[model samples]
Target: MAIVGGGPAGATLARLLAKDYKVLVIDKRRLDSDPQKGQFTKCCGGLIAPDAQKMLAKMGLALPQNVLVSPQIFAVRTIDINNKLERFYQRFYFNMDREKFDRWLISLLPDEVDLRCGSQFKHFEQEEDAVRIVLTQNNKTHIEHAKILVGADGAHSLVRKQLGIRGLVPREYISVQAKFTAKEIMPYFTAIFDKEITDYYSWIIPKEQHLLLGTALKPRENVSSKFELLQEKMKRYGIKLNKQVEKEGAFILRPMRVRQLSVGQSPIALIGEAGGWISPSSAEGLSYAFRSASYLAQAIKSDFKNYHKHYLDNITPLRRNIRLKNLKAPFMYNSQMRKWVMLSGLQSMQIDEN
Candidate 1:
């Protein structure tokens, strides 16, 4: 078996199947060594939400302290710039360094699995009984064959493209984020909604001595200008970003319908964002990644020949959750509805001014 991508989904699946199968994981980023070796660290809020925490508990995993970042979040301050309305909602998130977190997950992989870092998956070819995986590392090409191939690769997944299972693929957006030196830290996360900027959303997450300000923008649009505008708009709420230390961007998937989700056919399967398991409204993918990977692993273990059927059967709840989130999207994304919710203070909490 071979897995492309070493993110949470791939790593989790590798860990689960390592003991059972001869697994090989190909990841472009060198998490085991210098992550900065010409690799793009994913752009994310790096918050481990309650759902993700629960998944960890179910997996019998406990996060080490080194994975955590400072100013632990306990609330989310949602702001609607158009209505000048803002509300606080109780939420808990473990702020952690994403790269380090991925590295830790990879480190947990058993010795049975073959781990290949800094290796890029070029493409794949399916034969009669086995699949051919082509990878490039250090400008050299390598080919390997596997009976089962899993695509835990995230949005913009090449494996998904190769599957050619055509339906409604999830909508794609470019997420741009900048890390600025933090003069101070906020105790909670910030969610910003401004229709003028984007119908998606924006966010501010503090990571120890650095503050991250990011927004989801329509791809190919003036993303740089929009990001700058987002930074300026944040200043209105007294969230002035300090000198920028770094900037990063990545593609995020938004599944508007359950039909958009594809777990892949036999021989080739997908998990995490590649399978459209990410949340439609919040873009929270960690929980979905862990859950989907777990289901796939369970399916493979239960029945290899019928793994696809079992995988689909196991993900019924996940599909339902996506539908529920789709149903809730309007109340969160629609300006009028969101304004009403904010004005009504629905499900919102009042923070002590003192």
Candidate 2:
């Protein structure tokens, strides 16, 4: 089997399938022994709920205890049109260093799994039963054959385009995120939402040395302008910005149909964000990536049809509902709705009740 893209979804799938299948992971970037290489600019503030942690444990990976910056979610602070504060407190959440987490995950994969870093998937050809993949690494061309191809690539997935699958088109949505090492802010995951400023929310994830501050808006909104607004809010909260560590942004694509998960002639599957497993409303994709990779591994090992049914019946409906609700309530970003939904969901999982 061959997997494209070596992010969380690709790495997780490679590790899961390595035990039974000869897995080869191809990526556009080459893996360096240097730790810095794994520290790519991520838009996420790196807040993972306890339920997500439990899911990771089921996959034989445990969340690092010491990596968390804080665990005190004092309140869900929301700003109204009049700039009033609405606070709701249930429980605390953990903040992590995304770079550290990604590096750790990559290291957990077994040696048997062939990891080809800096190798970009140029294209592919489908035979009767297998796929012949073409890749370019260091200006050198290479070829590999596999019975199944898994695309764990990010939003701009080459695999999705190559398969000619019509799902969520590009430019449908956009989100901007930045990581900074600032003076330690409150040891909490605080979200501020307002419509007039930006049709999205801002987050502050306290870390050991600094805080991860980020803001996101839809494609139609001015992201750079939103970032500026986020900076001003940080200042208003007395959150000192020490230095800009990293900055990155990406388009958020919400697939209109769950069937887009299957995007190939056969023996090929798209997992993670590439598969459109992202939550349309919250734009949260990491947990979905982990879950999709696990499910895809199961299908590849047993029955492919079963994989489709399980994903569709168990997860797709909820995602669809969330998307529909988000479409109907675009004003959710106007107030405390986003934070409320997240807190409510976390509370429902007993993550906050405890």
Candidate 3:
């Protein structure tokens, strides 16, 4: 079997079946080498939720100290722009060195699994018994024939496009993850909500030696100017995000259709953001990516005939809930509704508001 895109989803799927199958995992990243300081993945805040942590531990892939960027966060402070309402939630997320995290996961894969990093998947042609995949490495082209093809490639997935699936309708948001210096990175996360800029929100996530500041813009427009606006808002909260050292921007995959998972027949499957398994509320992909891959691996192990149906049966509710959360975001935010929510016992970290 062949898995394209050696990300969290692909890596997790490979680990699950590698001992039994000769899984070939391909990625453009060089997973074999050690990363220099200040290296991270593109378009990633590198935050993992509690559920994802449990999943990793259960899979026998414990997170090492080298991969952690920050300690477990216990709370998130949220600020609304309209009325300047603020609230604190007990929920939390863990941050990591994105590059190191990916490498660590790659290390957990069975040595028997063929991990071909620095290689790119170009295209594939389906045959009677196996699919022939074209890949390029060191400027040389080669073909890989597999009994099954798994598309774990990300948002701009060539696999999805090749399958003739329609592009993300209503489109997705444009977001940027920027790193800035801080005196000491806090354990807590921050969310700044402003309807003027975006319906989703902006965030300040703590890391080991730096902080990650990011924002998502809806289909309406990009948030370059809004990013400036965020810097100003952050100043009021005593967080100065000046002189951005590094920045990466990309399109966040928003679910245009709830039931969209795989586009091809039995032997082919789509996983991760390629299948639109991204979280609707936060645009978070790791948890869903891992979950989708887990389900897909299970089905493949059971029976290929029941793969699609089994996956759909298991993931239908997950997609539905995300759709509901996306629909509720606009109404749940905004100044008018927030004013009432604050009055209805919402807590705040901002002392002036108290």
Per-model TM against the reference: 0.97, 0.80, 0.89
Give the clashing residue pairs of candidate 3, or none. Answer: none
**For model 1, what is the error of residue 39's alpha carbon versus the real structure, in angstroms, after optimal superposition?**
3.8
What CA RMSD would you report for each candidate?
Answer: 1.2, 4.8, 2.9
Query: lDDT for every model?
Result: 0.92, 0.66, 0.77
Q: What is the lDDT of residue 300 in candidate 2?
A: 65
Query: Cα deviation in Å at residue 118, candidate 3?
Result: 0.6
Error of 1 at 281 (Å): 0.8
Highest lDDT among the candidates is held by which one? Answer: 1
Off by over 4 Å in 3: 36-40, 167-170, 219-223, 260-264, 327-331, 346-354
Could you give candidate 3's per-residue lDDT for residues 1-354 as a string of tens digits?
A: 999988888888898889878899999878767855554455787888876777776676677888876656878877777777677777757678778788887898978999998899999999988999999999999899998898888877888788877544325678877888778756678887787767777888877667788988764664677777777767776886656788888777777456554534557788888777887766778878888888888877777666777776666666776778667655456568667876575554442322
Compose the digit string of candidate 1's lDDT tens values, residues 1-354: 999999999999999999999999999888687566556787788999999999999999999999898989899999899888989999988999888899899999999999998899999998999999999999999999999999999998999988885456898899998999977777789999998789899999998888899899999789999998889888867886779989999999999989999999898999999998999999999999999999999999999999999999999999999999999899999999998989998789989966
lDDT of 2 by residue, 30-112 (tens): 44344455444444667666545666878777667655655445444443433454444454455676656665677788989
CA lDDT, candidate 2, residue 160? 81
Per-model tally of clashing residue pairs: 0, 3, 0
> Residue 278's C-alpha lDDT in candidate 1?
98
